[model samples]
Every structure is written in C-alpha cells, then in structure tokens.
Target chain A: MSGPDLLVLATVATLAGSGIYLLLERSLTRIVLGVVLIGNGANLFILLSGGVTGRPPIRGLFGSEGISDPLPQVMILTAIVITLALTAFLLSLSHRAMRLTGDDEVRDDEEDRRVIARVERELARHRVREEVERMRRIHAEEGFRAGLRARLGLRGTVRRERRELRRRMREEWERQMAADDPEGGMDTTMGEDSP
Target chain B: MNNVLVPLPVVLPLLAAGLRLALAQRLVRVQRGISVAVLAAVVVIAAVLVYQTDHYGPQTMHPGGWPAPIAVMLVVDRLAALILLISGVITLCVLIYAIGQGASDNDESTPLTIFHPSFLVLLAGVADAFMAGDLFNLYVAFEMLLTASYVLITLGGTPARVRAGMTYVVVGILSSVILLIGVALCYAATGTLTLAQLAVRLADLPPDVRLVLQLTLLVAFGIKAAVFPLSAWLPDSYPTTPAPITAVFAGLLTKVGVYAIIRVQTLLFPGEALTELLLVAAACTMLVGILGAVSQTDIKRTLSFTLVSHIGYMMFGIALASRAGIAGAIFYVAHHITVQTTLFLVAGLVERRGGSTSMDRLGGLARVSPLVAVLFFIPAMNLSGIPPLSGFLGKLWLLRAGVQEGTWPAYALVGVALLTSLLTLYTMCHLWNRAFWGDRGKLPERGQIIEGRRGLSGTGIVATAAPGTMVGTAAALIVFATAFTVAAGPMAGYIDRAATELLDRRAYLTAVLP
Candidate 1:
C-alpha cells in the first residue's frame, strides 16, 4: 500500500522464495540455510504486519499511531531465539551427519526402498503360495474323480484303488487340520478315524 | 472455582525439570524420584482440574494477576483437563520405563541421565500447549516441546539418529515458521492474540481474509499432526529414537497439534469453510497412511505409519463438525494416546527380547516371554479396533457421526474408516505373525547379519530380558486403555459435554476474558 510496505513485502517474498529453493536442495547445510532464511522472512512479515515503521512503543510514546506495535517485535524476538537454537541444532546435525556418512548431503533412504521391495516380494510370494495350494487342491480333486471312474469301469483294481484313495483322503484331512490349528499340534484323531 | 490449581500441571513439571537439571551431575536415582513425584503430582492436579471443570465450569488463571487480554493466561476446561490427565499418566509410565531401561544399561549415569530432565520438560510443554489460552502462547508451547524432542530424538548421536534428527529438526522449524506467519496474519486481521478475544474479533473480518488465515493455520498444524502429504517425515524420524522417547512422541506430540487445530477451528473460526478440504485430507490421510503401514517391515515403523493413519479418524470427526463427531474425536484422541503408547512400549520390550525390531529376524516371542506377548496382544488388538475395546468404541462413535452427516463424502469416509480399521488389523496381524507366532528357527539369518553390519550395535535390538519396571509400565498403560472401555459410558458423557462447550464459545470466552 505504501513505499515501506512494498519494500518489506518484496524482501519477505525474496527471502521466503530463496529459502524454499534452498530447502529443496540435497545438502544438509543448504537446508539449514533455508530454515534460517525462512525464519527471517517470517519475522520480517510479522514486523511488517505491525504497520509502517514508527518509533518504538515505549511509555512516552506520542500516541498509538505514532508508536510501532511492540507485540510483533516481541514475537520477532522470540522467533529469532527459536531460530538461533534451531540453527545451532542443524549445524550440529550437519557435523554429525558428516561424521557418520563422511558427507553433508542427505542420502536417499535405502531402507525404505528396500522395505517396500521386500513387502512387495513377500506379497508376491504369498500369492504364489496361495495359487500353488489352490492348484494342488484342484488337481487332487480331479485325480480322485478319475480314479473313481477307473475303479468302477475295471473292478479288478477297485479294492486296491479304494484303499489308496482312502489313505490319500485321510492325509489331506490331516494336512487341512494341521493348517487350521493354532497350536500346531498333530491331530491324533486322524489315525484312529482312519483305522 | 479453585483457579490456583489451573497452572499447577504446567508449573509443577517445569519446576521439576529445573530441579532435575540442577542435580544432573548427581545420582540418577534422585533425579528419577523427583521427576516421578512431580509428574504424579501433576496427574493428581489434572484429575482435580477435570473434576472441578466438569462440576463448576472452566477454570482460568492469569499470570501476575493481569487481565486476560493483556497477559498470559492458562485455561483448564474439560478438554484441556482430560488431555492433561492422560498426558501426565502416560509421561509417568514412560518415565518409569526409561528409568528401568537406564538401570539395566552399562552406561547408567552418563548419556542416559539427561532423560529425566528432558522428559519433564516435554511434559511441561504438553501441559502448557493443552492449557494455553492464546495462539502465540500455543506456538511457544510447541517450540518448547519440540526443542525437548530434538534432544530426545538424537539422544545417542548415532549416525542414523543424527540423520533422522536432521530431517525432523528441519521440518519442525519450517512448520514453526509457517505457524508464526499465520499468527502474525491473524493478529493483523483481528488485532488480538488471546483466543477468546480472537473468537469475538475474527467473525467480523472479511470472508476472504478469514479463509486465508484459517487455511494458513491449518496447513501449519496439519504438518505437525502428520496429515497426508505432510507426514513423510514421521515414519522416517520416529523409528530411530529410543523406546521411551518414541513412545512419548508418538503418544502426545502430534496430538498437541491436533489440540491446537481443534481450539482454533472451534473458537476462532467456527464455520464449515474448510470442512470439505479437511474431509478430503482426512480420507487421503487414512488410505495413504495405512497403505504405508502395510508396507513397513519393522515394528516401530509400522506403528508409526499406523499412527499417521489414525490421525485421519480424528480429522474425520473434526471435519464432520457435529457434536457427536467432535465428542468421538475427543474420545478417540484419549483412547489412541493410551493404546498407541502401550503398543510402542511393548515393541520396545519385543526388541529387547528378540534382538531385532525387524520382523524378518524376530520370532517365538510368545514362547520366550508370554507376558510380553500378552501385553503386545491386548493393545495391538485394541488399536486394531477389536470389538469390546476402546478403539472399537471410538471408531463406532465416529462412524455413527459420519452416517448422521449422510453426505456422499461423509459416507465414503465411513467406508474408508471401516476399511482402514480392518487394514490396521491386517498390519498388526502381520507384525504378530512374524514377530510372535512363528518358530525362532524360521527367522532368516541374513537379517541378523545386516543388523550387525549397519554399525547400529549400540541401539540395535538385543536379546536382553526386559526389566520388571519397563514391562510393568507398559502393563499399566494397557490397564488404562482397558479402563477407557470399561468407563466408556461415563467418559463419553463427559466428552460430549466438553464438545458441547467447545461448540458454544460463549462459555469459553466468559471464562477466559472475564
């Protein structure tokens, strides 16, 4: 709206814009710089929002219009302290990162990528296992039906084939029961029932 | 009203933290005793505040006896009191867990000794955030907690912890800056910082300016709450911390952000201007967050993703903007704080017992320690929204609210919420299967080799017997979560009244500004 206001706005915009730009960089130092710039920009914005520059608000201020709002300055002071602490923290982090990885640049999170890949592989393995189990069941059912048809057509092997089929069915039942059991115990009833 | 008790929850913890710091070089046991006593006192104070507020309306205290508009004020209504009580209880449990952990370690006095003071400071920050009656005060409160978190997160200064802490610190500072900008904008528009006064002044601002101010605040708070697109830093950073620190952070920090959001939305900007936007964010946060959870391999990482996902349910309640919805959100917040912290604490135990948090290297926990298994199972099931648990009750309440709202988006969110709950169950079961039920022999040996190779030997999971106090603290959290279910009827009634008072701002304004 006025010259001082426009200058403050431009400065805030430039600082915030550059801050965001640096934030997108890969190095930890650049990121810290970004935070510093953005914090300064915010403080400036708060100061600007207090109104055009005026005398510091003190006990002897002429009037409200003649005195600058002390609240924003107080807020800016707090923000500055917070930013300084954060900057110091970030600098230490950068130093630590350099010591740990021998570099100050942020590396891609290989663990997360590996985890996603592992999860996908696990899901694929699970799907394959389910499909194999399904196919095996279908094949068993078909084989049983075929064996029954062959036994009825040829009575000579009927008795032997029926015995074999009964044994296979008992095994299948035991397997199913074992899969369903929470305790993973063998079902003793299968042997008794089979006899 | 006993206004004297209003600031005690915050002040007591601050005093204890200072005392702990002064005695930092002394015996650790003395520090632990003082920290625990102060937090216990805060819990009693919180409980008293809850009783007084519920029976006699909100209580307010202005520091230095200054009037509300000009000086810092602390207000303890039912919502704040409930949050304070739960945070105090959880912090106490986690403090015990930390002490137990430190006692078992070789370096009992040096590096780990700072935990007591830092944790007490964190509790003070939480209490202050919950009771803060002004927006700027809330910002300061956030910084206080976050500063302590930065220290806690990188406790050992390991490579991984440092890396994660860098990201955490950067994101936190960025969000704080955005929050400051929002506060400045709001002050510029409304000429007041006190929430009650802002409530009166904000309604008179131009609609466009109000919307801008509201969206700015929401964006900042959303990042802190780990709402969608803003939540990527959480899973990366949270899994690197020690058990007790991670448990407290996961339990209370983001919820503080959510508390601030609730305060502003209900008090300063009570309208449906951003409801649609929030609904979309809630739905996205739910689906995306859980999907991420389903994809994680480590127990802590999975729980972190689930934490992000569950924030959606609270947002769903907030977006609904109905009394039932808000009440459900409040209850869900309480239930989630307990259950989530319990699960993390148990995960810590699991790591201690199994030698690795990665599921590929963990197994036979059920056989190894039945108590740990049972502790993990209860909270895991509760968090998954199992019937008859507090999680189920909270989700049911939210769904009922959604159905009552009956908009197409709301219905869609109802469906998403249900799906998210089931998916949560699936993820928990996935963790349970690999970490608890399987044979120890079935675990891959390569995963153990990788853990050793990562140079994470100091913080890497180890097969140590969990201390009795650590397990006891986790068990206590589970008991609290169960108590939530047992006392659901009365708790829901209290939360409903809190929500009602929240929606009707005159009570809050009169209490603060009078």
Candidate 2:
C-alpha cells in the first residue's frame, strides 16, 4: 500500500466508524450527520477503489496510464446527489419531528407501549374472569353437597325416631298380651327367644 | 416484438409522472385518468414482455446502441418480466384504490396532486430495478424508488408519519450507502459494473475475496429485504404510512431487495459458500419475524411483521441454491406481492369502516360490511397459507425443495416454516376475533376518527361506508391472488423456466453481451 492509499483507508475507517456510532444516537440531528458521514465514507471508498491518485479522465490529457477510473467518480457523483437529497429529506423530517415533539431527538413509539400495556391488561382480565368462574363453580358444588348432607341427616333422624316408637308400641302390646295369657305366653316367648 | 419494448415498462411511467406533474394545475380527475391509463399500459407491456421472454428467452436492449460491456443495458428475462407483470398489476390496483379513496373522502389531508406523480415515479423505479442489467443501475433504481417512497410515506405530513419517515429514510440511505460500497468494492476487484461481466469476472477471484464481496452485498441487500436482524426499521416505518403507500411498499419494495439478492446469488456468486449462513438467517427471519407479528396488536403492524417473516421463505429458497429452490422462491415472491398487498388494502377498508385499525377498537365488521369481511377473509387466509391458496402452493414448493436438499438445517427450516405458517394463522385469527367476531355493541359508536395525528374525538360524526371502487379494487387483488392459485401449474412452470435461466449464467450473458 502507498501513502495516499493508507490515508484513504484510514479516512474510510474513521468516517464509517463515527457514522455508525452517531447513528446509534437518539438525536435526529446526530442521525442525519451519521448518514452524511457514512455517505462521504462510501464516496471516499469508491474513490480509493478507483485507485490512489490519478488525473481526470480526459481523452488526450496526460496519457491514459494514471487516469483515475472515471466510473467510480461518476458513481460518487450520483451517490453525492442521492445523499444530498436524502439529507434534505432528513432535515425536513427533523424539522417536522421537532415541531411535533418539541425536540430533535427520536421519541419512542407511545402507541406501541400503550398497545402492549392494553394487551397485558386484557390478558390479565381474561385470567381473572376464568379464575372467578372456576371459584364460582367450586362454591356451587360445595353448597349443593352441604344441602344434600343436611337432607340426608334429617331423613336418618326421622327413621331412627320412627323405629324407636314402633319398638315401644310392640313392647306395650306384648305387655298387654302377656298380662292376658301369662303361662302360655311365657312358655311360647321363652321358646321363641331360644330359637 | 421489438427490443425497444424492453425499456418501455420503465420509461412510460416516468413520462406519465412527468406529464402528471405538468398537469398538476389541471383537474384531479384528469390526472387520475392519465395515471391509470399509463399504469394500465405498463401492465400490458409487462404482460407482453412475459410472453416474449417465455417464448423467445431473455430480451436485451442498449439505450444508446453502445456495446454491451460498455453501454448500460436493460434485460427483460423471465424473472424480470414476471415480477414486472405482477408489480404492474399491483401498482395499478393500488392506484385505483387510492383514487377511489381520494374521490370518496375528498379530504384535503391526503393531497392527490402529490400522490399521483409520486406513485407513478415509484412504479417507474420498480420497473427499472426489475429490468436493470447493471449493478449501478440497480442502485440508481433503488434510489429512485426510495426517494419517491419518502414523499409518499410522509404524504399527509403528520407527526407520526414524519417520525416513521425519518427512520425509513435513514435506514434506506444507510443501506444504499452500503450497497454503493459493495458496488465499489466489486468494481475495484473487477474492472466492470455490469452484472454479467462481474459474474464472469468474480468467479476467477480467490475464495476469500469472493466471500468478502458476497458478504458485503448480502448485508446491504439483507437490510433492504428486511432479513431478521436488519428488519426492525420495517415494522415501525411501514405501518405509519398511508394505506395504499404501505400496501405498495409491502408488496414491491422489499421484494426488490429479494430480487437483487437472487440476481447476485445466482449470477455473481454461484457457489454455496454462504448457504448455511443464509439458511440460518432464513430460519431466524421466519421464526423471529412471525413472533414479532404475534406480539403486535395493530393490524398494519401485524401484517408488516408477516411481510418480514415471508421474506424468510424466499431466503430459504435462495439458500437451497438448487433450481427448484430458486424457482420456488420466485413463485413465492409473486404470490406474496399479491396476497400481502391485498391484505393491506382490506385493512385500509377496515380502517375506513371501523374508524380504527387497532383491533381492540374494531368489532363486528362482519355484520356491518359483509363485503369487507369477505374481502379481508380471502387474503388473510391466503396469507396464512391455508390450503388451496397461492400461499399454500408457494410454501409447499419451498418445503419440497428443502426436503430434497435433505440437510439437517434445511429440514429444521422445514419445521420452522410450518411453525411460521401456523403462527401466521394465529396472528390472523387473533385479528379476526378482535376485529370481526367480537361484540358490536361493545364498540364505540362509529365516527370519523382521523388516525395518528388526532385523538379519539368522537364528535358524533358517522363513519362513511367504503366506496365501491375501493372495495372493488381490493377484491380485484384478491381475485388475482386466487387466480395465482388456480393457475399454479402454469405459473410454477414459468417460474421454473425463469429459475433455470437464472441458474444457467450463459443464457443471460449471451443475451446481454451478444
């Protein structure tokens, strides 16, 4: 590599590096400057690629040996025009951005944040609703079971009381009968009891 | 047909845009008529080019009759013609949709005077990029389109649009600069900027140098194509633009980047040096992009993510580096342009009828406008890769190619692709449930809700019904998407031929250099 080549390479590196660094900034002006730096770096790269130092390509001007590649120059020219146009666009956009937000910095998308929050809230509401529905079903089942147990307990109590009354009635009847026919009843009762 | 028709696709639009600008002081209706007629002519020319290229092989033209290697040339190969035809039709439909919107609303917010000319310029740029036979010409074509898009994206000059436009312009400029550097590096290595010449010259270079050049170009084009890591600028930027603008950008712009990548990967660097890397990128692009879509609550934002995700499918095809894979990618590109554009148009109509594009604020559109719902349904399903749609056919071809490639990464990508499709469906269904099937009574009363710039001011203004032309235009795109499926056999055959020619470098070299 020669002197001009080394310088061109260094320039490309510095410009591209700083351009990328600036592009990462939140400020719109810095971003535009980044674009400009990158554009210039690209132009220099194209120029360097055309060869280190050469005279302009004119038909008979100083022989064709050292004449720079005209193609890269043309490309650089077109690139410069494009960059200028984009810079103009960026400037206008920066103006508009500043006007809208009262700043030249890029603002985060408020709608996106709000939408995400809203979606989270919606999901939470859905989960809560499902949870409440599940609890309600459990509560209904528990109440039904309690009501059934109470009814079953009452029926058990009524049956026991009825059995006791019947037993008493039978005993009273037996007593009366026993009184009426003591000897026969006593022998028969004893035989029945033994069987 | 004369080779002169080769440049007409690009030239006619530029001329019409110039004419429209001159006639700006005239009636808006007149300007609209001229724009439509011009784009319709472009569509016809594109169709004829497709037929010519398919029958007779690639067509080439030198603008000033200079020699092939010295003069700038336009090559209308099968791939270029096919993309041109599809984009022509899409731009026409979008123009009609915008005109309908403009006419119906008669709102001063969106100035028709600026839009018509800018849109025409955008068309010209797209055509130029598609047909460009040189790397520098492709860069210029990109700049043409990007400049025009800057104008269109910030049409209303709203604060939100300005912010989005800032990101878009910055990203676009940065990518172009990178591309310029790549072009310069290629030129520095090889003494030419013409792609065919570079294709011939680049193969002789050492593997290390070629790898560097290839990576440089891929990084530049990847940013443009919105491939995963380089794609964050897309979702934020695209959704804030006006509907037709977003539709066209989603349809054509990123695809142009994909087209450039295809051209270079097949023509300039024909080996598999970067295959695994690209495959990894493709897989990541698919999974990560769709995941982003799933997280978005806005319809436009979700669709933007889907746009990025599907670029992965194209990259997958490109990565396979086989005839079938490239062909499948071509077919996928065509299918995606139509389906994605159609979906965005429908979203626009939904915004018009529902008074908001936010899904939570939208509901019962199915009942309010059955036509809008139907319009949205067809394209949404098509986008989600439902059976019998072009999306399904494209994905199927890509997957089959991947399986035939039979690598672990390819197979893994197949699984990822299927999963992406399912996730895409989930996103679409989520949108459907929130925007169409939810309770109508829960919605705030319909009103003229200006978006982005204004707060939700429901001043008791009733939302107007969508104009028939807008719905018809969107339906026409849906019909085209369906037609893509119906004609899948022939379309696939065409794409296969295109891919074959693209892979066989001698065909393009001979066509141009001869």
Candidate 3:
C-alpha cells in the first residue's frame, strides 16, 4: 500500500522480462510458465497504476477520508479470472504439443514450412515485378510525350495559335453585334483599321 | 421466467451433464434427447432475447432481484445477441449432425455417451459467457466452457485426439492461471468485479496504472483471439478435432475472445494508446496469419491458419475506435463466424469423401461430390472477399473506415488488407484444386468411408448419407452469410448503432453503476 510506484512498476517489469526469458527457452513447460509470470507482471503494473492512496477501496458507510480507486481492482478481478481459464487451456495445449511430437521446443513441420516459405518468396517477387512495371510505364509515358512535342512543335504553336484565334474571334463577335444593332457606326473605323 | 432463463444458459448443460454422467447411464437415447432439447430451448430463448434486445436496449436480469455490481446479472446486448444467434444455429446443426452420425462406431464407449452432455455443456458455457455482466461470472463461464471442451476434445481418447486434447488442456490451464493472477491483481487495484463499474473506475485510475491493466487484459484476450505472435497453438490443435466440434470452436471460441477485446477496448479503455497498439497488433495478425495459411497443404490446417489470419481484419476495425471501424468489426465478426465454420465443416466432408484432409490424398472430389464441392466453393469464395458476399462487404467496410481515418498506419494497413485478401484467395484455390477437382483421388477408399467395425454399414450409410447434414449446415450458414451481404446496408447500420452504443458507454455504465 505504501511502496513507490517506480519500485512496483520495476518489479513487474523485471518479472515480465524473466517471463520473456523463459518463453525464449524452447521447452513447452518453461514457455507456459514464462507466460504465466509475464501475465503476473502485467497485472502488477495495472495494480500499481491505481496509485497507493491511503487505503484499499472498501469504503463502507458514511464519510470516506481517502480510498484507493475501485475501478482497477474490479478490472483486475475480471482480468485475473479470464487469464486463469486461458492459462489452463494453454497449458493443456502445451503438454499435448510435447507428447504429439517428441520435442519440447516447437519445431515447424518441415513440409508445411517449406510450402509457406515458397509462397512468401513468390509473393515478394511478384510485388517487386509490379513496382518495376509501374516505373517502366511512367518512363515510357514521359518519353512518348516528349517525342510528340518535338515532332509537332505543339507547345509554342498551340500557344500562339490559340492567342491569335482568340483575338480574331473577339473582333468578329464585336462587328456582328454592331452590324445587328447599327447603334454605333464607329465600328466602321475599326473594320477599316483591321483590313 | 426471467430468473430461470437468466441462469439456464449456464445451468442446463451443467445439470444435464452431471445427471447423465451420474444416473442416466443406461438410457443413451434419453440422455441425448434431453441434451438436444435443452439446447434447442436455449436457442429459442436466445432468439427471443435477440428480438427483445433489438426493440428495447440490452436485457439485464439480476438473479434474486439484486442490483447489478452486487448480485450477478445477465445482460444481453446487440453484440451478445448476434453471438447467441450464431451459436444457436451452429449448435442445432452440429447436434443434428452428431445424431445422424450415430455417436461413434463404438456406442458402448463412455466417451460416446458423454458427447451429448459435453456438447450441451459447451453451449451452456458459450451462452453464459455472452450473457455475463460481471467479470467474475465471465471467468466462471470460461471455466464452464473449457471443462466441457476438455471432455469433448478428448472424448474418444484415441491416441491422436488425446494428444491434441492434452495440448489444449495444458494451454487452457496456463491461461486460466494467468487469468486468475490478473483477476486477483484487478481486485487489489479496483476492488469490484462488475464490468460497467470497472469502466468508470478504471478511467479515474492514474494513467500508468490504467495502461498496465489495459495491456494485461488485451494480452489475455489476444491469446484467445490468436493474434499473430501469440497464436502458435491454433493450427496444430484445431485441425485434429472431429468436424462438428471443430466447427463450433472455429465459429465461436476465438470470436468470443474478439468480442471480449472489443468490449474491453471500447468500453473499459477508450484511450488512444490502446487503440494504436491494437491497430498494430491487428496488422501483424492479418499479415502473419495469411502468410502461414498460404503454405499449408492440408485443408483443415490451411483453414485454421486462415482463421487466425482473418482475426486481424476484425481487430483492425476494433482498433480504429471510430464508429465505422467498430461497426465494420462487428459485422466482420458475424461474417467470419459463419464463413469460418462453414469452411471447416466443408473440410470435414471432404475428409469423409477423400479419406484424408491432405491435398495429396484428396483430388477430383468435385467430380464425385458436386454437392460437397459447391458447399466448399461458396464459403471459400466468400472468405476470400469476393463480391456480393459477406466477407467482401465486411472487408470493404473495414478498409473504407481505415482509409477514412487517414492515419499513415491505418492507410498502410488497408494495403495490407488488400494483400491478405488475395492470399486468402490463393490458399482457398489450393484447397479447391486438390479436394474437389480430380478423379479417383477424390473418392475415399471404402475403408476410409467408415473408420471402424461396429455396425459399419449403418455408420457408413450415415457418413455417405449424401453428406446431407454437412451440406445442409453449410447451406443454412451460407444463407445467413448472404443475408449479411445483401442486407449489408441495414446490417451495417445496426452495427454502426451498436458501435455508437459501445463508444458512448453511458447506457452500459449508468445502467450498472448508477
């Protein structure tokens, strides 16, 4: 109830580290035990997070001076129960795995592993090929556009032609409006200048 | 009605199993009938609960009329209802299949007799798990199911089954012990056992404390869900079981863990860090799972691996913590539960026909058993995310949600998802190629048709009895899976609503604690 949060956290972390170390050991029994220890460390971390307030959260009747948060306690209860059931099931699995194959360490079935590895290699190759194809298409498009531009003088000619065409169209439109309305005879001077 | 019904899910199978084991030794028919009838009644009750839950909010009934957080309560929410519906339909089909298959070649074996009772107990455990409102109750439910599963997996005690069962039991025991430690720690931290209460209480805890608790809970559930790194036990253990048992376990067990993860992530710890961690775990799960699945030649093993891989998709949705993601995840759960089980059942049928689950031993099944081929084909395609199927729709929603989130990781995960889908297709194709498409390879030798000598004719007739039970089960599931597909708009909407309900947490938290 009065331990430093850092110390509590450190203890759990150490336990977890040990659990992982055990897990790394090949035997199924050690691996399961490692898992169990790791889980304990995790639970301890959760407990430490609630803070070591004055007292455990069991406030009964009337005024409460200071009580620990009740939420984490309840959550841990649920979590503990679940892990217990899970651990049991997993332990059963580990024991059976050991018996089925005379080895304690999990050895991948050779055939299964080979097939899996081959499929992965193929997928990786396919992805690389796709990337190459994408780059090639991008390169080809750039070359084609550049070649077409040179042969046609398309950029400058298109720009100049569009400008000239716009000027002519505007002048034509103005003359047509003036002719139809006959309201402004000054359009005659403009036509003469244009000719 | 409320009182009895509230506890029936846990009590019925347990009581029936106890009685059958003790006094009903002579009357096998009576034992089987009672077990089946009780399960049927559980299904009916669960259906009614589903209807009621949809109309009203979640249905919570406390035994002895005690207030929640003090007395144990059974709450059936939309998610719970969905699982119940699936469990019901699957249990019915499996029970029928078992009945049709005639227990075993040896009727006198105690294992054969216990099948009915054990199967019922498993269902009861599942029901209790779904309905439990308190964390401690969930543990009890888990134990109930595990105890039953232990019996079912090792029922015949054949060398292989026992071997597999031993692994299952040991792993299970280890998880239980860890769970207990975690629970004890939680109690020391928060001092309560109710879920809703803990949700509020947990938020108030210091950040570090909360994070630690959250991670511990996730790890426990992760193992159950078979998330990538923790999933080594699944492929070996699942494929070796009898079809019906495998089917149920495939469909419901892992999903239950996922359901728990969803509940914990959204309801208990809505922190951003947890979501981020979940997203990463999900990505690893999907990529790693499918990769493992692709290399397998045995149909059952392949599907089992895929099952682990596909769990990532569900986790992806849940990890996003957005309404769309959670909804998509929920829909994915429903879809995967049906599709996955159907695939396993199909594998079972193929084994019956071809005398082996290995691709080498099986070929040309499509020629001999068109019905089996079709059954296998539909679910296979559906699982691979083909259009107009629930699998495709579920993935689509999840990917869209991921993209919409626009986080770099989420976007990258969407890409991972696309790749996984393709790989799923490839492995499924492999199963199709070797199991259904060839000549004599597709047919089981007459000896393989029936395993042993006791009334081989009767059993063989049942085994080859058109594989109707298998087909029928697949067909019914496909219909539901398709319903999720065609009605995805409405179903997704329901999921969205449920997601909102989960995220808001007002109803759940207030109902229990206030």
- Give the docking tier of candidate 2: incorrect
Q: How many clashing pairs does model 1 include?
A: 0
**Tens-digit lDDT track for model 1 on B1-514?**
2388988888888898888778777866677788889989999999999999999888998877776688888888899999989999999899888777766653454446666777888888899999998889999999999999998888767655776788888889889988999999988887788889988998888899988999999999999999997988998899877788899999999899888888888888887437788899999999998999998878998999999999999999999989988998999999999998999999888877775587877888888778999999999999999999999999999999999999999999999999999999999999899889879734333224222311111433334568799999999999899999899889999999999999997788888876
DockQ for the candidate 2 complex? 0.18
Off by over 4 Å in 2: A110-112, A115-195, B107-110, B441-462
Error of 2 at B49 (Å): 0.6
Model 1 stretches with alpha carbons more than 4 Å out: A61-65, A110-112, A115-195, B442-462
Which TM-score value belongs to model 2?
0.87
DockQ of each: 0.20, 0.18, 0.05
Error of 1 at A108 (Å): 1.5
State residue B513's C-alpha deviation in candidate 2, in Å: 1.4
Which candidate, 1 or 3, would have the higher TM-score against the true structure? 1
**Best candidate according to lDDT:** 2
Off by over 4 Å in 3: A1-195, B1-4, B103-108, B445-467, B486-490
Better of 2 and 3 by TM-score: 2
TM-score of 3: 0.75
